[model samples]
Target: RLLTKMFSNHLQKKLTTLSTLTDLTISLDGWTDNSGNSLYSFMALKENQEIVLDILDLLADHHTGNFLKDKLKEVLSINGIKILSIIACVTDNPSNIAKVCMGVSVYEQGFRYCLSLSETARPKYPEIENITIKNIISDRYHFANNDALTKVIKPIVDAIGRLESNDSTLADIFKELINIHQQISQLEVPINGLKAHALAIISKRAREFDSDIFFIALFLSPPHKFLAISRKMSGDKIIRASLELAKTWNFKKIDTSLLFKDLLSYKNNDPPFDTPFKSSSQSLRSYWSEFTGNAPLLHRFAMKVLVIVLHGASCERLFSSLGLIKSKIRNRLTPDNLSILGQLRNELKKTVHIKENSNKTVTEFSTYNKARPTGF
Candidate 1:
């Protein structure tokens, strides 16, 4: 019971600190433990200072959404965790949890719009006057005696058909029709000279134009494909400069990789420390040599805490403690009592803070003294 109380105190402190400092990115996973009990694991960056793994919930054989939601609510209440700032959820393919609405499902579809703007060689002859040609090619030339233009638009119509009755995808089809009108706004060919070849060329270009539009739509998509384009742009100074044309009004977040590279290359021996510890501890020695040259003890301690805690082992150890405590007693536990026990176990691992005296110099002593009796 004493050990359990210490654990609770430690966990409470960590959870409080996490809530205070960092924007959290939470991931949840459910699994069966060795004891054949169902458990949900939650991991998050707490306070951006520490990574914490928590047994967010435990459940009986019959688990449901209500069970999950209730457990989430319970955690929030205990931690005083009001809002989730960022969330990343991972699950198996065709996961039912992917559903956003009842009886309605969404499937991601890939589309490419082909534009005729890029020419391999010299420019072709000027396109004939103002008929909107679409890229959709079909063998049929006419629909209800209207002409071949109507047949070219069948794909848009078909896409709209899949949507719910009178939905906005149907409206989007009409919007594309208007876009067609705008494309041929400058064409001046006489109606009588609208030859088969001219119509064919216009149709081809229209298809290409639709493809361009599709690509633009992809930029506004979820799981955006712009990262590849952004990477290419960053590689080209001219492209990056062009993107930053508006000096005052045009600013964008530089990609993190670019920012980190610039930060690391600030000086000949910058970036202070090497995280992966390569080559004989040379960089680390250089960092301390430079740091201890001027900085105080408090600064050294701050840096030490930052570096030592960066690795994920801290959270892993916490998880092991959770297993040690909860695995045997979970079936007999209540949620509230289990949460209390989890909190106590977490605190036991952290070092206690002892304030240094103002007048006296701090000194290290090596003698071991027993504060309490040891028992196996």
Candidate 2:
């Protein structure tokens, strides 16, 4: 009770300080736990703040799309989060996530084919795009259309998945899409003749992310400081994009005098944090940290845009810690108690000075509980 309350109150106070914050990315994903309970996970980040993972209970019986929408609204409302604050919602191509992204399904066919293709033997997609078989020859198209097609197409799919799983990946989507486009262009050539239609279906889905928000995400990242514009864009286009982004952030509106003169001057200049971190994941993490200190405006945009980690991998890892605290013997733990345990453990892990596995804190809690409850 004390542990969770302490950390919960502390974190809430921290979030309240983000009054000026906007465009926050909150990745929502749900899973069935070892106890067969359907629970959801959320990971929220903005600017230079640490990613906060929250495990929320899904008390309803069915997990339909509409139900999920209401549940999420409730969660966000309780946390005082705004829908407009979210830039993107990342999840493994699940139907529910698709529904959440848009009110309805846009890529149902593509999603179905993506799964069927992931397996060893491809599920019969019947007819895809322009390819058809009236006069039957061999089942080559049928058999090869599934897993083999998926294997050939995995380069693009896997790369995008890598981008999705990135801690600070939202900003890299557009740049990475360019990379995917290049990969597909490379693969499209070798895939001539009869198997061409399969490639078309795969390519269409890969190129579906045409939103400008993706490009904005790419532009904010330090490594790809400017999204790889060389393929379809020139220096002129680059300047235009920077100008527009600047305007979108109201940079020009704030200081209208030197709109082009101020920002465009740094146009081609390289950010000191451009290079990749050789070993640490925190390499990219450091870029925002450094920029926020010196450039608060750009930092705000970076925070507004950088968001996503769909598989709930971070949240799942959190569940493991929760498991340690609320073991089988402690299985009777209430949701409130479990939350405190989870948050307290998370708080402990965040600070190196606070020994996580140390018995001192646990012993102190034990002493306090025993002393208060006893007649002594």
Candidate 3:
């Protein structure tokens, strides 16, 4: 009991610190555990790190849009996080979650359909009439269509995976969306039939990309600036969006003329931008850090926008961890205790590494003291 109290206090302190950050992206997901408990996980992502905020057990509560929205507000309020600090909220493509972020910037995961046409759309041969199943399987046209569909869907699945990575940025997502559109639009034959259908879906889902914030993120990305230009995204539009976002953050005294000049120089690959990085694998944030003195405004803006988390994988990961921690044998654990234990496990994962050598498990700590909060 004493240990649980200590951990809970530490987590509260972390939450207090988290509330002070600006332009944070919140990721949410929900799932049911083996013991019939409905659980919802919330996480906050800033820069490259993700902080597991809380997990709620919604006992006897209806999972409606308004209910979920109120619960989310309660969580944010308890943690001292202001709505203004949240740049975006990411979740799966569910109507309730969409409604929760009605007035706020939200990004829903793209449509996911099973690519295996036969397995997904049809039943087993034994289950259906043998003759009918045989005829469907023997159709050459069906095979051709399935092959074409796979070609289109495979790239989208790969793009989704890239976007879900911890290091992925809004710029990366914008580039992927553009690449998907181009790949379909520039096909050898003009759009028709399956291609046209796929293109339409992409267009519908790409509506979120119409927001200038996404374009601004792409514009500020050093490696992707040329890609944005080639895609015909307007520089003037990006500038307007940047200024608008800056004003929201209360940067009223910013030099608009200097920002414009710096953007032009950046786009043109002038002196400071011309130099190659010391390492090819340098991160976008690190790359932007080098030019802070020359492009102070852009650098400050890039640091805020470039780190937006593009997926809800963090919440999904928390659910997975919770499942293991709250197994059948431990099914009786209370919600408060479960949350504390789950958090401790997550913290340990960062500092503890176990290696097996000579049939023995050896545990190593990168920063033992840092892993445990004060007084633990």
Better of 1 and 2 by TM-score: 2
Per-residue lDDT tens digits for candidate 1, residues 231-333, read 3222233223322321222223453334334323321223432132233533322333244322233233222222221123334445466567656655666
Query: Which segments of model 3 are wrong by more than 4 Å?
Result: 2-6, 9-13, 16-22, 62-67, 82-85, 94-148, 181-196, 226-233, 255-261, 264-282, 327-337, 353-376
Candidate 2's residue-wise lDDT over 198-229, tens digit each? 44655575457544545445545545645444
Clashing pairs in 3: none
> Per-residue lDDT of 1-376 in model 3, one digit per residue for the tens?
8777768776776777785788889887888887777888777788666777778989689999899888889888877788988878888664323222222111211111222343456753223346675565556454555455556665577677788887788888777887888887766433248788878988888875777777787777776776665344676667767777777766656466566677777778885667665676886767776664577766777777877787787777777888898899888987867877777777666434322342242233535655878887
What value of lDDT does candidate 3 attain over all alpha carbons? 0.71
Instruction: Count steric clashes of candidate 1.
Output: 21
* Deviation in Å, model 2, residue 180 alpha carbon: 5.2
The TM-score, computed over Cα atoms with residue i paired to residue i, of candidate 3 is: 0.70
In model 2, which regions exceed 4 Å deviation?
1-23, 34-36, 46-54, 61-92, 95-161, 164-167, 174-202, 219-252, 255-313, 316-338, 352-376
**Model 3 residue-pair collision total:** 0
User: Residue 159 deviation, candidate 2, in Å?
Assistant: 2.9
- Number of backbone-clashing residue pairs for each candidate, in the order shown: 21, 4, 0
Q: For all the candidates, what are their Cα RMSDs to the real structure?
A: 23.6, 13.1, 10.3
